[model samples]
Target: MNDTPGWASPGSAPSDGQQPGTPGASAPDDRPDDAPRPAAPTEQPGTDPQGPGSKWSKEQPPPAQWSAPTGPQDPAQTPPPPPPGPGWGNQPPGGPSGGQGGWGTPGGPGGGYGGTGGPGGGYGGAWGTGWGGPPPAAKPGVIPLRPLGVGEILDGAVSTMRTYWRTVLGISLTVAVLTEIIVILVQGLFLNDYADTSALEDPSATFSELASAMGSALLGSGVVFVISLVGTVIATALLTTVTSRAVLGRPVTTGEAWRDARPQVLKLFGLIILLMLIAVGVTLVGILPGLLIALAGGSTAGAALAVLGGLSAAIVALWLMIRFSLASPALMLEKQGIRKALARSAKLVRGSWWRVFGIQLLAAIIANIVAAIVVIPFTFLAAALSGDGVGSFLDGTGDFGWTFLIISGIGSVIGSMITLPITAGVTVLLYIDQRIRREALDLELSRAAGVQHPAPGTTPGS
Candidate 1:
């Protein structure tokens, strides 16, 4: 098989016994039509005979070897196509003996494997014109080496979770169980009074009583929110490492993921807190003027301004949130500081705000839906097992006793075990997709994955 690369153009030879485009060709017929012609020279064969050592071979071959055999021949002894040379086995694309399709078609252009023609003809005849789409991309792991679509991004996330479920679930379950235990203990021991929120529900409560109840409730909720955020931060940090390796088709143990992520954990936590504060600060600034107006006895005007300002602030916050949504992955994967990670995220998100927003929103919706599907049934079962039963729980009057707390916390833990990896994986994959579109990250990933790119103009795996 001749494996040399390149295609010969398909055109007829010149009439002057020379290939077209060769150095010599008959001059254009510009001579006068009636110009005199020289007498042609003729020689007798014996008169032109040369002496010994002439630049020609004079040996004669056996007469029968010059032609094909006249009798029937054994099919098993049929010869293969002639070795690679001009015209590459004397067949053209779709010739009488060549099959109709594929590079491998017998006697087709580019004498591919399985063809009667020797495998020397290059794909010059039908590369772009006949070969359908571009070649499939290299897929080292969960995603192909290209800019990802929405479904691909989601699928990559789920694939990462499924492919490395043991390590992924281990990290998530540990973090979730620990976080939930802390929350339950804190609520049971320190917030029992705040948990009894009936005082705020009373229609005739005094303003001071209502204010106190709201403050206590806020305190309880703030504690829970902070705990949840910490758990999320830890899970994101570890899973970032796992997902990054998963992209390169590398399997990582939990210990390895932890070691890789440990250095960046504190910085990731700080970045998350900073982003939260920025959002909250914007919100506070929006309502500050209205708050001042209200304190100065302009209550009606203050309320209107606060509503309008709050909405504008919310819009700004949402924009900022989406803009910095990738910061966690950036910080973890790049081992970047809070400021640098935030800057990197903003830079990557510059031209693709809507795309990033839609992907993030979609992932969140999917993760939440999955979590709700798992947690809701467990919650109802817990309620029924508790003294309140399902009706009282739904009515919002059930006491959250130890039974309720433990049962509901178990549901929360299980739900988080399923969801944490997915959310983290999607965020990491989105970061990678953006980098691929903007910076050609796929080449780097291919190198890391040990994928060998084919040489230009050569078939892959040739």
Candidate 2:
């Protein structure tokens, strides 16, 4: 009798008298007799009758005989047809297949190789889709209309100048020239009177004389500070508009920027004044206790109180400054009042204090570096050109003539022209970035730019 393993098809069974598990049977005898046997071959559960594991199943049909065609067969052999359904026979080496390779076919909806869905996709596989896709491409502007990195913020500032050099440079140069001229005139007319060395060299100089000199110096400095503050506010207001238009890839003239910014100039100035007053008040309050103590004749205790109070006041002032740094841009762009702008700034900065602070600090450092690069050489030239040379310049013992002032003013103008736009642009862009992250202002920006369709997840007025 045919005696191949019972699992073999009838026609393929051996023509011998051995059954499966016998010494001469093709089936291996690894299992002990007592071991539980798999389901019977005729009704094996979960096993595909035609699969590789079931090659010897009795249900399999006999193989078809191969016959040469009447004409010459093609030299290349025809590949075997794939199995009917999903299984190893149809699967590629890479993975499950509908085509070449596996599920990770290149250039498919699933990104190249194992990537899930191109750049739009977050990562790979089901997990990537579940997590959602990446943010949409930012529209062109001074910035990319997204959460900005520090480098991008800095670049945006520089780009504002490069993109709109004439308007930006004109505004800055006018302000710088006017400011320098005013400063030089004030010094030459009033402040320079007290800069004489005779008063310093006089052995009989009284305390009142010294007090008068200090008071004069303070007054001059205060006047200069006020002028500088006014110029800064104007620059900031105008530049805020420039930056806004630049962000939308729109050109803005100095006239247009000035006109738009003019309405908000007073509000911005008020905001600056309010902030300054708050800072000054806080510092004064902190130092008041120490001043009282000192006046009461407790020198050591007064000194200690002064130190503690100053430190406490400084901390509070720094915190508030950071919290409200965006107020200028908010006021200028939104045309909000002092209190509203302050509130808006506080809201935007609520959870991003450190980030804002770090960026502002870095911008300040960069501005200073740029200023130094321009100013340092001019300082040396001024000193060398002065009749008294370096000694008189360093010691402040010689008169600073028109030549020194003019040369230094040139440097000041150059430095201001570059630094003003950068500082103002960074501030505006920072405000916009914060809004984009916290409030999705990019939608409004896109709409304003005449974008026909908003990106996914962005709704109108949202």
Candidate 3:
């Protein structure tokens, strides 16, 4: 068996004279290019001149130095210089100059990681590094300063609650308690009369009596609705400031949020009222033709026309509502008047009608689902505790005493406490997301956060 290393064996070692496969070897003019030439081996001290296996002897002299051919030879027959070693000819291992795809080299159509001047250039290449920019500058806030996706929006809302649980939950709980109390009071005072629907089961009941009952119910509901709306507005206003500060990674007290939001409350209120008026006006206009027909005579044709008109109006109202959904946030945050906020919302939502509508609808659905999850069990428990079964409670056939109302109101409060933050947070984030996408609001947010390197030419707060 050969004891020497495979490379140092006679078959592989470079001979003293020009060897067939060594750098001094000549190439055939017609031969196709072959593998790259190997670099000349440097002589190591203490190595035998003949071979690694040979022992040094007094008679043997050191190996002679390698020398280049002095005379000019046929250009076609001369082999190219041996390839340089790693880092020897300004080429890093596995780098571009090494003829292997590596960092800063165009790996393919879209440049690979760190490649430049290609379709996919920069970090992770243009083919998408599976992320948008670098992991957004560490977010100390509820959300990162970037265009948000649905999951991110939801996460941010949750993050706000998690990061500032005391303030967020306190605000939500207070609003929920107040709203629920008002609703319960209204129901107790005004809706008690309609709580018993036994009159409707009586054969002696007249259409006028039924209409009167409905009217009373409507009146009570309207009052409660107004109160709830006011509570929601206040909560949203205060929470918007909290959320805005949260985006900058700042913690806020309930008092701080209240103080910041108070100045804009009236403006927010006016904006809400204006929006309601516009919605009501649109609805009235859309249903006017049908209303006039129905009032003239309650004929089948009139009923059909009324239905058609009301349907048309409802569609328009829905569109308008979605179109101006961001107005409240804009009004509160920007301190703009109702008209300007409405205009701002309209501009942001102009080209993104379906997108905004879909996101809003999804958020509403999620909120409702969450509320139901929290409220349904309480409702059932309330019914059971009140001596009414679930069926009777759901059917509204059982007597609804103060006990039942209070228990149900507790459930409502709990549900509201949980859902209010989520819904309000989602709405605010959606507004910010739209602005980030359209207006590059992330740059402003970054500047506000004192990020070391904000997008160039972007002034803070601009």
Candidate 4:
């Protein structure tokens, strides 16, 4: 090795215009342009006192054989950052695992070492949930209020329809058609009845004619109404069974849905009929109040009507809401009396009536709108067809006596098919929710829905 800084052999041609450090050497400015100087004393392998003016350490360990450390041995390069403040990192000193020293043993909790007898070998209580942190605060309505994926929900509905649409739709439609036929028959039998009874027609008439027409129409309509009511109840029950089965991913026979529907048939009918009565009563009272107010002849009768009707309807609606929110669940899951079912529904819907109401209304409105869109044209057709049957029933009130009845019945059936499933789905879901609230249904459902059932008698709420 050359003793001089950048001095070439004493007699060699000078390199790069040089000044040599030695008394008689060729030179490249004594700085050697081809090589580089170490930045720090600790970075250089050997001291270079006789080299370029740069300082270098003689015993620096070859600068770690790699690039200097920058920003902590990157987590990717090092073992996942010591797992924060605890030794989830590795086994500590004298530990069982083959961790390079200072790592704890795998037998940390029980009899092996000084760990708290925590389940996973460390202080189990030391972590909030071992899931990383405190449970996130549940946002109130924001979590579930938004409509879920339409495609998913509709897909479930479509599947339900596929399995159930045949029997349910067929039965409901048959009942509807039968009712419509009866309505047309009765309309033909007593074509003059509506005018006699209605306030819009002439008052004085022949008594026998009026009596005959009125009696026939009343008997006829009553029969149709009863049939329609029964049909609707059956439809609701069946739809609920189908919807529940769909949600649970279990296939059900239409016969099974019908069977399940049997238990709640009368209850559903009674409930619906009761609601209808209340609605009629509400409309009467609501309209009466408006009329009375208007008879006082205020300049604001319309507004008063709008306001009063709205308030009254709202009250009635709320009551109905509290009453029926859990009806389907009651029907689907319980084998009890109407009063008990109502009580169960009430209890389940206690604090969440408004939510249930909103959801129910949403389901109803959506179903009704969809049903209406589907049925309106069919209604027109039925009415037109019936007009041919009762040519002069109204002479020309659009002559819609028999036509109206027939169309109304047919439209009702179409409406029921579309709406019943949606209503059932909504009610059943609410029922499940109530179960969650009253019975911890979420956890229970999680368990029930698990691969194997959870512990034998570990019911949800319990």
Superposition TM-score, candidate 3 onto the true structure: 0.68
Instruction: Answer with 3 or 4, whichever has the higher TM-score.
Output: 3
TM of each candidate vs. truth: 0.68, 0.68, 0.68, 0.51
248-328 in candidate 2: lDDT tens per residue?
999999999888988887777788789889887898899889879876888678868977998899899999989998999
lDDT of each: 0.75, 0.74, 0.71, 0.53
Determine the C-alpha RMSD for candidate 2 after optimal superposition of all C-alphas.
11.1
C-alpha positional error of residue 292 in candidate 3 after TM-score superposition, expressed in Å:
2.6
> Cα lDDT for residue 183, model 1?
94
Q: Which candidate is the best by lDDT?
A: 1
> Which lDDT tens digits does candidate 1 get at residues 1-462?
321111211111224344434443223344343343221112233432233423223443443333334555666886764443432333323433233333343443444432334335544443333334345678989998777888888999999999999999999999999999999899878887555566788999864466477768877997898788778878988898899989989999999998998888778778878977998799888887877786688877886787788889999998998898888888887777899899999999999999999888888898789889988988888899889889999888887778888988999999999988888888899999998878878888888899964333332220
lDDT of 3: 0.71
Model 4 CA deviation exceeding 4 Å by range:
1-80, 84-155, 167-192, 195-230, 270-314, 382-396, 401-415, 446-462
Give the backbone clash total of model 1: 0
Q: Which wins on lDDT, candidate 1 or candidate 2?
A: 1
